[model samples]
Target: MSDSSALTQKLQQQVLELPPESLPDLEKFIEFLRFKFQPRKPKATAKPALDATHAVRLGGLLQGYDFSPELLKEARREMWRKFYVEAE
Candidate 1:
């Protein structure tokens, strides 16, 4: 017999000699070996499409906001003051 087949037979004989109480642990180890050796499937690359519901919710959220440059500058300065000043 081939070396691999001989080794497999020897392992099988040893497993058969093991007590019944140890059989469950042996089964778990065999399962772990199978899982470890199995090839992994590739993950999907395509992103899920965004629906109209998200767009409507976002529009509602920003409906009353001013997006002017001056407003953004004031918001940034306020954030800097709140975090940086307090950190010191």
Candidate 2:
């Protein structure tokens, strides 16, 4: 027989030698192998349309607050100050 057939026969013999109680676990392993190696279908790339009714209103909460780039920069610097500390 060919090498592939010989290997297949050897695997079959080993599987046959396994106890009946271990069959369920062997079946689960075979299923896992099949699922792991199975070819997968490509997912749809199209996104669903957004509903205008559910759309968020920007700057609605902070309408009365004065927002500035400098304030944001200072807040970020203060928040991340601990991460930039140098070791003595």
Candidate 3:
């Protein structure tokens, strides 16, 4: 007989010799083994595409803000006015 069949016969003989009161515990252990060894299905991981209704509005918070280079330079100068070194 093949090793697998021999092992199966051995398990059958052992189970047959087990007391009736232990059968329920054996059934639960068999279920645990089946769950532990069963093949697992791959999980679906596709993300839903964002439509126009859920799209983010870029620069939405700065609709009326001025970003002119001259204004930016003046602001930077005002911020660092006290840090300027006087030339001797």
What TM-score should be assigned to candidate 1? 0.49
Q: What is the Cα-based TM-score of model 3?
A: 0.50
Off by over 4 Å in 2: 45-88
Per-residue CA lDDT of candidate 1, range 1-88, in tens? Answer: 9999999999999999999999999999999999999998866896667887555444586687798999999999999999998999
What are the models' TM-scores?
0.49, 0.51, 0.50
lDDT of 3: 0.90
Residue lDDT tens for model 3, 25-81: 999999999999999986689667799888997767987889999999999997677
**Model 1 RMSD to the real structure?**
6.8
TM-score winner between 1 and 2, please give it: 2
Per-residue error at 82 for model 2, in Å?
Answer: 6.3
Task: List per-prediction Cα lDDT, in the order shown.
Answer: 0.90, 0.88, 0.90
Q: Write the per-residue lDDT of candidate 2 for residues 1-88, one digit (tens) a residue.
A: 9999999999999999999999999999999999999999766986667799778878688687766999988888986786677532
